[model samples]
Every structure is written in C-alpha cells, then in structure tokens.
Target: MTAASFTAGLRSALRQRFRTLALLPRLLHSFWQTSPALSAAIIVLRLLRAAQPPLVLFIGKLIVDEIILQTASPAPGPTLADWVESGRLSAVAGWLLLEFLLVATANALARIGAFVERVLTERHDNALGVALIQQVASLDLRDIEASSAQDRLQRARTQRFMGNQLLTSLLSQAQDFVSLILFVIGLLSYAPLLIVLLLLALLPTLAGEAHFNAKGYGLNVSVTPERRQMDYIQIVGSVAESAKEMKLFGLGAYLAGRFAELADKVHRGNRDLAARRTLWGSLFGAIASLAYYAAYAVIAWRALKGELGIGDLTFLAGSLLRLNGLFERLILGLTQITSQTQYLDDFFSFMDLRSTMVAPSNPRPFPVPMRQGIVFDKVGFRYPGKGAWALRDLSFSIPVGETLALVGENGAGKTTIVKLLTRLYEPDEGRILVDGIDIRDIDIAELQHQVGAIFQDFVRYHMTAAENIGIGRVGCLSDRPRVIEAAQKSLAHPLIETLPEGYEQMLGRVFARGLDLSGGEWQKIAIARAYFRDAAILILDEPTAALDARAEAEIFERFRNLSEAKTALLISHRFATVRMADRILVLENGAILESGSHEELIALHGRYAELFALQAAGFQ
Candidate 1:
C-alpha cells in the first residue's frame, strides 16, 4: 500500500476502536463541572503516589549500602568504637525512620486516591443515570418504540454503572504505570539481571490475564439470550400484574424451570472457561516460579563468591518482589480496560442513536390552548419493516369543542390514529395539521405539551400515590394541590383516602411500607394521571376496562362533563360509552366503515350497529 493509504487505514481503524475515548474530553468536562474539588484531589493524590515509589526504592538502596559497609571486615571499615563515637548508629536509625516515613506517605496517598476516586465515581454515576433517564423521556414517542433504538437504550442502562468504575480504574492504572516505571529504573541501578528475571516472570501472567479477559468478554456476548431470558423470568415472577396469573395458571414453576435451565447454561459455559483459564494460569505459574528461584540462586552464589554484598542481595530480592506486584497490576489493569471497551461501545451507541423522525430546523410555535381543531389530510403510515400500511390514505377532522369516539375491533388501527394525532408517529403518506399548520412544522415539545393520552396498557408506576398522578405533568411533579384535584376529578381520591398515608402512601410492594392496589384502583390512578396533564387534546384507550359498572358509568359521566367544549378522542369497545360521543367513527380492516351519531349509525345498521348490538346483548 502507498504510505498515505496505509496511514489513512490505520487512522480509520483507531477511530473505530477508540471512538468512545474521543468522548473522554466531554466526559471529563462534565466531571470537572460537577465535582471540581474531588477532581483536583484525585489528581494531587495520584501525583503524590507516583512520586513516593522512587523515593522508597532510593531509601532502600541507601539502607542496603549502609549495612554492607557496616558489616565489612575491620581493615577498611570503621570499628565498633569508631562507629559509636562518630554517631553512625543514630545516623542509620534516622535513615530507617525516614524510609518508614516515605512508606507511610505512599500508603496514605494511595488511600486518598482511592477515596477521591470513589466519591467522584458515585457522583458521576448518579449524574449519568439521571441524564440517561431524562434523555429517554425527551425522545420522540415513535423513536422510543423503535426496536433498534430500545436495544441501544437497554445496552446503555446496563453499562452506566460499570462505566464509572472503568473510568476510575483507567486513571488509577495510569498513575500506577508511572510509579512502576520509576521503581523499575531505581532497581535497575542496583541489579540489572533482577529486572530481566522479573520481566520474564510477568510474561506468563500477562498472557494468562489477556486470555482470561478475552474469554470473559466472549462469554458475556454469547450469553446475551440466556441473560435476557433470565431477566424476563424475573420480571414475570415479580411484577404484581403478572403474579396472579403466574399462580392461578401454575406458570411459576414453568418459568422457574426455564430460568434454571438458562442459569445452568450460563454457569456451565463460565465454568468451562474458568477451568481453561485455571489450567493456563497453573502452567504459567510453575514456569514463573522456576525463573524466580533461578534468579535467587544466581544472587546467592554472587553473594557467597564475594562478587556481591549480603545487603545487595537483600535489595535485589525486595526489588524483585515489588516488580512482580507492579507488573501483575499493570497487565491486569490493561486487560480490564480492553474488556470494558465493549461496554463503552454499547453506552455511546445508545447516546448517539439517529432518529427517523427529525425535528424541523426552524419549528413553528404552538399557539396555547389550541384555538382550532386537529385535521388528518390523506394520512397514511407503516411501521418500520412492515409491508402493509397500518393507516392508509385516511382523512378526518376533529372539531374543537366536540367529543369524537373511534370504535373498532382489534387491529383496525384505532390506536394508530391516536398515536399519529398525538405526533407520536409521523405519517409517511400525508400531512396531519394542527390549527391548519402541518404538525411537522410545529415544535415537537410544544405539540406533546398540548396532548394527554392513556394507552390500553398504561404504566403502573411503583411510586407514591401523589407521584403516580403528578408524573403526568412532570414539570410540576411536586404540585400537591394539583395532584389532589386531578385525583378527585378521576374519582381516585376515595381510594387514596382509604390508604394509611393518603397521598403519601406507597402504591406498589416493591419497596417497604408499599401496598398493592387492585386493577380497578390502578385504572383510576391512571385516569387521574391523564386528568392531571390538563392538555387541550385528550385521548383514552380502553381506560375503563378494569372498573366496575357503577364506577365506569360515573367516570364516563365525569368525563362527559369535563370534556365539554374540548377536543377529545375516546377508543372503547363499550357501546354505552360510545353512545355518549357526539360522533362515532367505525373502523374495520384499517378503513373507516361508517361515521355518524349513535342514532344515525343504528339507522344505517352497518358495522358500528352490528358491534353495538353484540355488546348490548351482553348487558341483556
């Protein structure tokens, strides 16, 4: 290859491998801003730790030299009387004290480094966790639902905790490498051969560690399915909604068996890998031990032959031990970093996901209170990877100050209509207009702010009663009076009143002092959440499914009163609720079959009438 081409290829490879490293500056900037004092302390402690090792090695060599001179024959060396008279004993004792001081200083600095790193890591973890959750919240609804996007999100959540540890470990390793180099250079001046022997000893351990790390990462990657299955089992076995069915249907044991099978598969794979690693480690360990003893024999022979002093032998042995520890730590740290790079890849991939539905560069402002109604003009949409359209060339308008109901069986695209109207999904074929302006032109945040929706399977948050309702308007999540008012509006206040702590009562059994709510009560809480939003456009999808007849009727009546002069869309299978809507649109096979008031639809005797009669028969 040409020199330029080779250089370009190398650069590209590095960019691919170390893309997350490129983001380190930004990550460090955030850390500095969040905890400047802790960051400074870490840097100072690391520098101190780097400086202390060479000082200790220098003091060690001095002590060794002093002992050698003192033990030498009386011809050139000072006699015991001369040594005492010259205060040489006190001088040696002072040197030993200084050496001890240096050792103590090194240990203290290391402890300080650890403490600072721990504090910074915890702070970074909390900040990143909150940031990720907020990013997920801010994402467009359709983007959040995309399978690839969700996969990235899951990966990010998994790596977030470990990412902080990886960062701190990298910093510590860098500092330790500096210390190791200085210590080795100091030892080289005393015994060069010992350095060579120490290096040889480290090679086998380094090789074993590298292999172990690679195997561990491979095992993690291969067991993704087993891990996901185990997680699914845990959720099904623990969640309140699934608990009843799990027991009644006798699915608990079945799920437990599946979980055990997956666990066994993972355990066996890990055990096999560990056994191989152990074998490699043992073989290398034997070689390393032999090399060390050979080096020891050479030092002892040199000392006996008067080629080296006894104190020099002691210094050589001590340096060899320290070198072993230093090299092992260096190799282990490098392997840890290599393995953690995969986690960093996953974390950055989530943060960098590209959205299909991009916001406009210059979005139009959404007028407050939505003076006009919403219109769908030749709207069509297809989910990603689907061959057919969920909604095709459909046109409809919901006028202001009116209640519109969409009645359809499953898979008739009723929910899709609400999703598009709320701008959760953009139409591929045509435009949806809000106040006569294309929704694409409006600010996404503003558009979402004007809408409130309750899905068929709404989330049952494991939080306090007030938080469950207040989260609907997250910006005002602590507004107690507003939460209470919303709860009252949805007839959930009575349920809250029965709780021991009223609004402060925990709503799920996941935490201490938590109480589980019945399905009907949870429905009321969800309804209150929608009510708390107080948006201009409201959508309810099977919101009354869990309510008793009396409660359902009362809620519908309250909804009717609350929705007066407001634009609302209701999706329900209950004929009684559909009858209250000013107009009903009957959908079949992804197309509108009929649209009229209840009486008009009954007169036509179309799909709407047929479905209505079928439901009415249930009541009879």
Candidate 2:
C-alpha cells in the first residue's frame, strides 16, 4: 500500500505482462488439442466476425451517401407510385436492402459461434481437471503437505475454474484486435490524427487497469494461507469427518465466529482496492470520451465547410466510436490475460515438480520371496524442515518369517521405523537392505507392493463396506470372496454381515442410508483392509489402538495364525501383546534401547522390564 511498494508492483506487473504474452501460444495449443474441430470452428467464426463490423460501417456510409444524393437531385416524386414510375427509388432502396442482409447474416453467425464456444470451453475445463489430478497423484507426500505448495495449488484451481470465461476473453481479444486494425485503416483516410489521439487517451486507462490487477493478484497470493485455513475451518465445522468431535466440543459458535473474522478481513481488503480502482477508472474513461467527441466535432466542422460530405462525417464518427471501444477492450483484455498468466505459472510449476521418491532408471530386480530378511545399516532419518532426527543411528534386523514387536511410547521412532521400512520416507544416512540388495535400488512400486502396513491413524473411506476393505488390495477390489475372507480373518465379518446391504452397505454418515461405525469397529475394517493385501511383509502399527483389551488379544491371535508363514512388524504400547512376539525391541528417542526375547528383557529388569512390570501390576 506504500508509494514505494506500489511503484515496485507496477514494475513487476509490466514484466509479468510481457512474459505472459509469450506464453499465450501455449494456451492456444491447449485449446487446439482439446478438440481440433471446435478449435478450427472458433477461429473461422472469429475471422468472419472481425471483418463484419468494418463492413457494416462502410455499408452504412454508402446508404447515407445514397440518401444525400437522392434528396439533392430532383429525380423522385413525392409519392412512391410516381417515384416507381420514374424508376428513381430503385437504386437507394436496393442499397438499404444490401445493408440489412449483411447485418442479418452477421447476427446468425454470432449465435452459431456462441454454441460452439460453450462446448469447447467445457471440454477444455474437464481436460485440465484430469491433468491436475494426475499430476497431484505423482507428487511426493512432502510436496503435497507443504503450505507453499497448497497456496500455489489454490491459485491454480481458481484459474482452472475460469476456463469458460478465459476462452471467451481470448477469442474476443483476438476479434477486437483485428477489428481495431481495420477501423484504423478506415479512420486514416478521414483524419489520421484521430487514431493517434484515441491511442493516447487509452494509455492512462491501461496503466490503471494493470496496476489494480497486480494489486488484486498480490492480495490473493498473500492471503492464500488464510484462505486455505478458512476452507479447513469450514470443513471441520460441517464435514462428517469432524461432526462428532465438533458437537462434542460445542464448537459451532466458535468456528462461525473465527470464519466471520477471517472472511471479513479478506473482503475489506478487496473493497478498498476496488474503490480506488473505480475512482481512477472513471477519470480515465471520461478522458477517453472527451477524445472521441473532439474528433467528432472536427469532422462536423469539415462537413459544414463543404470539405466533407454528411455521409463521411457520419462514417467517421461511427468508426471513431467503435475504434474507441475496441481499443479499450484490447487494453483491458491484455491486462486480464497477463494477470491470469500469474496463476498459470503456479499450475505449470506444480506440474514440473519432480519427486525425489522415485525409482532409478535402471532399477535392480526386487527380492522375490525376500530370503535374508530386512536390515538397517547405521540408518538415520529426519523429516524435511525439521531440525531433530525422527530416527538416528538405528541398526537392526527383522529375520525372515519372524514377528518383531516394537514397544515404545509416543514419538519413540517406532512409527518412523515402520515408515522407513515401507520406503515412505528414506533415511538421511546409511541404507536399508532387503536380502543384501539396497531397498532404494528396487522399483518403488514393486517395493510397496510387497509390504502392507496399517498405521494407527488409518483412513476410513466413505465407500461401501466391501470397498473399504478391498482398497488395501486394489487388484482384488471387485473380488467379493477375497474381501469376505479378509474381513473374517480380521474379526470384522460379524458386524459387517449385520448391515442392511451386507458387503455393499455404504460406510460413514456422509450419504443417505450410510452406516457410521464406532472407533473400534472402524479399526476392525482398517485391519481387514491390511489383511486383504496378503503382503509378504505385514506391518501393524498398533492397528488395535482403538480396541478393548479382549478385542485386541483376539485380533492379534487371529493375525498370528494368518501370518505364521509371513514376516511381520508390530508396534504397540501394550506389554501383553509385546510378550507374544518372537522378539521384543524397546525404542526411545528414535533409537533402540534394548532388544531380546520378552523373557530375557524381563530377566534383565531394564527399561523394558520396568515398563512391563508396571503394566502387569496395574492388572493385579
């Protein structure tokens, strides 16, 4: 808002304008690729439409001249019958009909063009949405979670929503530019000075438009974080995911108040900018009107002095008025095109983002039947932008065909280790190996395909009961028998069987006739999904965190039977479950404190033993 900042913004806007102008061809290419037939039709329509305006003006001039000639000459009688008898009315009458035909045809063509434009714009918008979704799927978790990326994504989404209007503006901009050129040629013959004066008048208006557009864009980008937060607050207040929590906490008034506060701030900023823009715009527009009339007055004086005819005066005035409008539109269109291009930068930048979480071009073959177990050689990992390590100097092994239970308190690196094993996040130092081959060398998809994990915070998709379980093994999503078997193994089948629609019953309260399960029931469904995977390495990151003690025991007992032949990784705070594992690892601060059989650890009476005894004492 400061004078210096405003000046800097103006300079930046100018640069953005030229840069965007260079990218205009890319947009044209996108349109062409959406539908070649529609693209060609639009171009043809614009060409015809652009030439029609100047042609109509010229025809008007001819009609006016014919009228003047007929009135001055003593060729026609007062009555139409007498004029027809003398054959003096035919020439002027034919001229009027010719002009009428041109105008009628132009109107018909405009209607056809509008229909074609509507279809083309819809197709382009759908195509863009598909492309954005595909690109987002390829992005890394880190990139997708970043606040800056979300801002860029928000702006990009806004631009995408303008597909229909953008297409119209582009075609209109092209048409107006062509019409302006033709109008100039017509004006030059009458008085070249009028054309020059017209351009000079529009300069101030152009500058004002460009300045306000930049300010508007600046404000939008600055408030993106707030906008994203506002959206989140609204979702939390109204969405099924948070409905229970919101009501439980009595947060309706608090959330509404917060939303009002943020929305008002954004609205007031926009209102202030609009007021200034309108004031300057009005002044510039008045100046433009004055320039047009100055040229009209000059032409009228020439006509009165017999230097020009009445038809020439009329033609010149009409042409000046049209040229004035076209120039204004062209300037405004240029500003809009330039402004939208800033958002296009965000979209293209996101599309160009390359994730570090990709397989090598020449990937080593993944370990089939992974023989020698998984190993961590002095591994360390820290999340992006975090100063502290999530896991550091961690060296361990989980032998093939063994169930290793990792016991730890919150933030003890147990889940981080699970993430590393799954290759969701790679280590900052050292390496993890599968049967002596570095896991990084394996294909990313292949690595993921072999390891199935259900974290504590698993998603409960608002889909059919069958789909909820089958999503873990997408290849078997439609295989109903497989889904039922997995559900039975996870002890979720009994509850699911009671649903009105059975396996087809919709989950969550989002839809009509949908069923919302309790926390523990949802956990059963999540565990069933993991079971459906039938992965070689099954990881349960406290998937039973929501279950009661008896339910937890029964679920793990079923898991032990189902996974007897497969390697497993279990993370739980429950010492009772920990004692069932082939081996126990106690972790703290992302490093392993002790590791042994449960009996050996209890015999040693270390941290693990003390924690185990504390829990056992509670039971007694």
Best by lDDT: 2
Write the residue-wise lDDT of candidate 1 on 1-620 in tens digits.
25585356445433443554555566667678779999888888887777776677667777878766765645333576777776656657778999899888888887877887888888888898888887787676777876666656776788887678777777878788887787777666766777677677877676566556656766886776578678879998988778779889999889989999999999999998889778877887787777777877777887899887666666667666666677677766766775676677677667666556778899998766667888889888888788888988888888887889999889999999988888778788999987898989987878888888888899989899999999999998999999999999999999999999999999899889999998899999999999999998889999898998889999999998998867899999888888988899998766788999999999998888888888888878
Each candidate: RMSD = 4.6, 2.4
lDDT agreement of model 1 with the native: 0.81
Would you list the clashing residue pairs of candidate 1?
A: none
Q: Could you give candidate 2's per-residue lDDT for residues 86-176 as a string of tens digits?
A: 8777877787788788788889889999999989888898998999898887677667777777887887777776556666888899999
Superposition TM-score, candidate 2 onto the true structure = 0.93
Model 2 spans with C-alpha error above 4 angstroms: 1-8, 74-101, 617-620
- Superposed model 1: Cα runs more than 4 Å off: 1-30, 73-86, 146-150, 188-212, 281-307
Q: Note the Cα lDDT for every prediction shown.
A: 0.81, 0.87
The local lDDT score (0 to 100) that residue 416 gets in candidate 1 is: 92
Candidate 2 overall Cα lDDT vs. reference?
0.87
Give the clashing pairs for model 2: none
Write down the worst ten-residue block by lDDT for model 2. Answer: 158-167
